[model samples]
Target: MSILDYRRQSVRTAAPRRLYQAALAALALAVFVLGTAASVDGCTPARDPRFVGTATCMTCHKGITASDLRDHFAGPHAAIDCETCHGPGLEHVRAGGRNGILIDNPGDDPFGATPDLCARCHADAVDGHAMTTHFTKGAASCNDCHNVHKPGGFVFASDPDRFLDNAGYVQLCGECHAQQTGEFLRSGHATKDAVTCGGCHDLHVPATFTAPPENNQLCQQCHASFFLGLDSPEAVDFHTGAFHPVDPAGSGASRCVTCHLPPQRRTNQDRGPHDHSLLTLRPAETNALIAQGMTPPPNSCAGILGCHDASVPGSGAPFNLDHPSDNTVLQRFFDQIGGIPEKVQ
Candidate 1:
């Protein structure tokens, strides 16, 4: 062949070889990319060997150790590691998960390591929260009501209703208030609403039971118009004649439940809880027996027990010997003032 023909033939062969090489390179690149993706998918960097999950994380949570794990952790996510709540602890567990790599990056793939991430499990709680006056404002979170590793236990674990029965209900309420539960038990409205710790309070949203406005709002929930005329100028004067003290802020202060029906004289057999009844005696006839001397000291015709101190005269009308007479006058006064009487003859 000629020299030019030879050159052309070499060029043609070299062109095909170059194209084949280029194709092979492309295939190799694709394989590399696919392999890289698969590796990333299968091995999520293999969480650190030292990583202790939530169970281990709970070891130090002394405060929540006594809480009900069954109520709070009874779900699939319960098995999730504590690092999931705090963050991936590869670096943390290696260095000890305290103040280590706080996988708090919002852009992370799971995007659930943020403080707000707990909302996923607490969505129902968030929706039913009392109001904007409480945790709904975002000042609190699942951590406020629950410990990630340890919860507050069943708020009403002892109650049959799973809400709060009488005894268990009072105990939970007594946690924050050492005196109020006892007073509430003695109040007239106790049996009417079958009120208990869970009656007006939501343990999960403690503010619903604690906040002043919230407390009054809860009272109004069952009271309806109990305080309707309370703001009027004559309300104080009128209530004074009908109720023991009439002044909400006075030494003889009475709540709405106090005047309508007062606590019974006898202590409860179970928890010394008061029995609310309008009559001084539970049956009214008991009051007649006391007055007739059929019953002894501490028992009276008015059904009042130990309330009469004839020597003290008017030290306290309700507890004084003349209480029955005073109560009668007051009842009449209330009737004249358009106030409803207790209905007991």
Candidate 2:
């Protein structure tokens, strides 16, 4: 018989005694490791070294730049001690990091610490960061987004929005969200002053983050007479007897995005978030009308949403939605590109 046929015929049904001994040894090792882990609650056992201070750790880690040390000691996080993050580095210092606890960011913790470790200190900071797609699904760590242990440790923001990471926020967040950064930069928000990535986004929040006014309140935060658009006396204008109320709460919770900013094609991988353009075009309604060879109305968006008695075909462009000058600008731009400027893959 061939070698294969001979091997099949000569099968040994029972595993050897030595294999059993090896399995027992492995089980014992696992239990011992688990027991050691359980002794210290979750982190490493206290058998390591107790944390001394920055002075002790710095004595060995001489490579830490002077500016970094200054920032650490005199900066925003000066109140917090170093050992809480890097763990007790006493063993790390004595062992010279060859076989000891190596101090690194959360993303590269040698012992594989979870985001909850961060949540310990920042208990009230980022409400939903741990549950975000960036954390749970994408396996991203907090340090990946927020620069740690450095000068101006947090974001680089502008006036009014001191919490903004205006300086490094764009480039740091753009590392993964390139397509979003491009669209955002081209947006009027970027063209306008006093707005940045953190101006609208909570980095601690999930992939799609919206600030206070945009999330819970109306678009009037920017579009109202009080903010920037002097033309939006919407409170008085829409309250007229035969008014077309755009208020979501007043008119059956109809969102601004219901007509203006619906979902668009993917710009970044298969990410399913809608377009950040925030334009007033309903491509679905327009495409349907054009398929029937109907002309797009230049002004007067009254009939499509049934605010008017007469049937105006196509997505009737909303009337008095913005200033006449703003309408001109939007139309000119829409007709030029048909959509956003550059959508990266």
Candidate 3:
């Protein structure tokens, strides 16, 4: 062959070899890209097996299934997930063993968990509840008055008779608050079919017990007329005068319980107690004194006195000091004339 022909053939051979090498490189790059994508799609970080979702929790909690999602889940803790209280359960699901996850063991977790655990998201609740008599005595807990799954679902409406008939509810509260429950049943407020414990108390958020516009306001549900006149201009003027010792503004600001049912004794010697009779004075004693033709001491009238005395003959005497028959008026006149240190003053 000619020298030029040999050189041309050699060049053509090398060209095909180069083309083959280029094709192989392209194939290798495609494989590498595919491999990377596959790794990203198939391989994921291993999550702890003990981390199960709420559905897993619901499976074993069959008894509470009906109430598990009632009332649109309204309450202080309704938003919280089941795992938050039951703990992680991924390992339990995989191993088919119950030991891995911390299921709500009623026996072991009497309160369903530590109060602090519930307090994690409930810091404000813990602080406010601490101020209450329940928390101070250590009888209070997240589950003590509430069920995380079902909350505010079974509230007693205006009718309290139905509430008293609820066996389960009565048992739950009556177990510990036996005396208070009994007193509530026998109280005039309850006897008149006026209000229930739920009327003034928020079971879900016990910290917000006797909330504003409703704490003292709840009393007005029965005493609607009295309440209407209580804030009237004439009533304000009369109360501010010699009649009501408590200033209208001050009394308005203060809770009804603070004046009427003052905290005199506690549930126990060590516990802080609050009176539920809703009176400012002893009814039996005041009646005895009135029978003896003697007037009760100051701060004893209407609410201050145990029984309502709006109709008593001398009930309005002290307040109407200008009355001719009022002893206070006579005593004041004698004090001014005789200079006897003013018996009424």
Candidate 4:
């Protein structure tokens, strides 16, 4: 019983010890793997000495006047650390928060560095905005219209109340487009509050009167009844008839804006922007403007390019009111065609 019993007892104890060693090895391996991952993913100073952490930046950046750092904590970017968008702040902090130090101010560099910084998180928005007139014309930037700290800063057409009065988004755009804004303010769009600038104008998309189908779609959003074949027979005839021949959904040349937003005839008529007043420019009105000796002459109907130009078989030439007879004929043409739909009149 002595040797045999001793051997069995040793085997049992050795087996338990071996199992404990293997468990300890696995635990050590897991700890090592996690620690390496943390080192790689975590924002530690050793990873990049310039990243001093949000806490470090907050130590001196609490004031609203000097820095929005205080307000930042209460904003949409609350969860996002300062350095994420601002870049590393160690050099800025060391420089005593100097104005032009290492810290990034997206507002200051809106067109350039701002787009790049925001693209890291908002690639789609940046890409979409790139296609707009704002970007192409260098007329505005992201921060120009957006309040970086507030979610309400971003204007959307669906959120009417916010877009209408939240921050006077139209006024902001008006700063650049003074003429259009002035006309728009007095026009039905602004006076009635039926729609905001964002209602028809997509701030981030290619837009113009040339793309009739695309531009007409914006008008159809509100004027859908005019396109849905729900209008009176006269109204339907007014749009699709031989006289007007406008198909909003079709690949046609005529557009809603083409009639409503006639070009303000300047010396060089082609260069002028279409009227934003949204007033229908019938031949009768054009006659009145021409009779009033309106300089450059308002070319609403007879002068819109690709409309009733010389391209038409019977249409002789574009009438710029150079001759009195053309004006007479234009008026008669409208009278014979039964004029615009009563709804628009």
Candidate 5:
């Protein structure tokens, strides 16, 4: 046979093979695209039908009626069905009890006291809390801190931003951290009913119960009162260009914690045992000071509980209350944060 004729025959045979390879590649690509789409949209595969609704369960367990279901139906999780967290109820309702809530065994429930059930929906939010002392070591449950059935902190309050008490988050949180809450209650902020757990805390994103130690992101959200400069409420602002030259973003005194919530000695493995008094060690109550007409203390709040002493300096600080910031040395001693480090001793 001629070489040209042989080449023509080979080309004709390769065409179908190439087409077969192309078809296989196309099929594989289609499978991959669909698989990814399913995963991204969170589509679950078919499973045995088990849910029978909250009404069915109430029928058998007459005592556990709609009254028991009222609180759960009213909260933010209102849309979520009882079966979502409590497994399914067809068997339990038929059999009559807690058997349906279990995963493997007949009566071993995963949600009685642990954060496991809540984690199913709140994995990201509970990530930090899950690793914290309260959840892990303390063996505390989600229900202990949050009344999952009835969340009324915002709904029941007059200010909508307050309560942190009286069926509010503050009261709920205080239930566990009683001493800390009590200390917080005595603080000027509490006295004014200005803040709550949700105010400084993003419960969904805490590093721990008290993981975040008063950073700028959390502080700026509410206390922008000083962001306006001398025209601010106290006729003194905390931002730059005020006499205090504070780095609002700074971590220590340059920020708010230095003097206001000065660090307290750690107790019970607490990292940031904040004073919660929220006091400036000897705040310049100008009007009250004028009435008293006496020279201010050398360091308004100098000591371990405050910031820098009246004497030494660092980061252009060591602000002295004795030599308070007037127009003269304003920028240098600006926002004078007093007190030496609590560890100074």
Candidate 6:
């Protein structure tokens, strides 16, 4: 009776153990078969719906013209994978452009009003741009000036005479800075053959000036003078060493633009663009305008904040805007430079 009872209990336990072993074997076999299948299929796992290649993206993106494709291929970002910027397109593709929200499109917010998406790769440019008026003033963004599909990432590709001229750049900038562009167009710097807007300004950099204007490095690029204490020697020693005493006194106002690019008074007396004509407005010319009843005429010498207002070394008293002859120091300088030629006036 004891042997029979023990035998029946062992059979019940053995049946359950056998069923568990079979289930484990089946699960292992399934895993092995799936692994083998994956290996056979060029080592690609079952299609991850998150990331599909650019080729898959292009399949349904038939609206992208042949020329646009050529531009993308020829662009600076040609080597980069499309998903590097737009993000994985598998979800977007599966929905056949119906769920475009699945993909990241920087162009959706072209002004970069949101967090800068281009900053992922162009962090330096974005950081530099943050300090510029274009960013600080909410005027422009990366895509506002740049075209990702262009070779140089510039939006100048739209111009009929692209790359061969700077008209495109001027036109682009003029879209926003109309008054400044107008002034620049009339200035001596606007020679079509040389010295366009880009020569002085870099959009990606802070303040747009290629170098700090406070130090006169921007003007010094074209106007090489011993006054700047630069490497080159000047024929005349007028600005710093002997003639002008302010710079030696550590007065930071001794910049080239202080005299040459004096602020031109606008119609409403709103602080207008500096005189782009590059004219050194003489005290004599200012006095002449004063005599003609045009009081407080737009002249560099008098308009300067601290120069003539305080006693300049040679000019004994504060400069007399009333009498041209009274302005001995500046008039003598004008006389030396051929008496403020009508060209500058």
Q: TM-score for each prediction?
A: 0.35, 0.55, 0.47, 0.68, 0.53, 0.64
Off by over 4 Å in 6: 1-48, 60-69, 98-102, 110-115, 158-165, 225-242, 245-254, 266-272, 282-297, 303-306, 309-317, 320-332, 338-345
lDDT of 5 at 11: 99
Better of 2 and 3 by TM-score: 2
lDDT by residue (27-66, candidate 6, tens digit) is: 4344434544444233232244355554544443445311
Better of 5 and 6 by TM-score: 6
TM-score of 3: 0.47
Across 1-345, the per-residue lDDT of candidate 1 in tens digits comes to 999999999999988865654454344344434443444332332234433344433432233322234533543355554455555433432332233244343434232233356555666455546343435455433333333432323333342234446676566556645566656677554655456656555644535553232123444454334344444324444543443334434333333333333333333211222223322332233335447875322222222222323433333434333345543443443443323222211
What clash count goes with each model? 4, 8, 8, 0, 10, 0
Better of 1 and 3 by TM-score: 3
Worst 10 residues of 6 by lDDT: 336-345
Q: Which candidate is the best by TM-score?
A: 4
Per-residue lDDT of 147-206 in model 3, one digit per residue for the tens? 544444233221222243334444566777776666666667667666666666654454
What's the CA RMSD for each of the models? 20.9, 14.0, 23.3, 19.3, 22.3, 17.6
Q: Which of the numbered candidates is closest to the native, going by highest lDDT?
A: 4
lDDT of 2 at 15: 40
Better of 4 and 6 by lDDT: 4
Sort the candidates on lDDT, descending order: 4, 6, 5, 2, 3, 1
Of the two candidates 2 and 5, the one with more favorable TM-score, higher being better, is: 2
How far residue 87's Cα lies from its native spot in candidate 1, in Å, is 2.3
Candidate 2, lDDT over the whole model: 0.45
Error of 4 at 172 (Å): 1.4
- Candidate 5 local lDDT, 1-345, one digit each (tens): 899999999999978865654454344344434443444222322122454554443343333321354555556676665556666544454332432233233124343444566677777757867655665565555655555555542323223232354336555676667766777788766787767655665554445423334444345444444332223322223332243444444554344555455444412212556556666544444224434876533222342332444343442345553454531243334354332222122
- Local accuracy by lDDT, each model: 0.41, 0.45, 0.45, 0.59, 0.47, 0.58
TM accuracy, model 2: 0.55
Candidate 2, residues 176-246, lDDT tens digits: the string is 87766776666676666456676556656655456343232344445444434323334323322123333
Please report how far candidate 4 places residue 293 from its true position, in Å: 4.2
Backbone clashes in model 4, listed as residue pairs:
none
Q: Which residue pairs clash within candidate 6? A: none
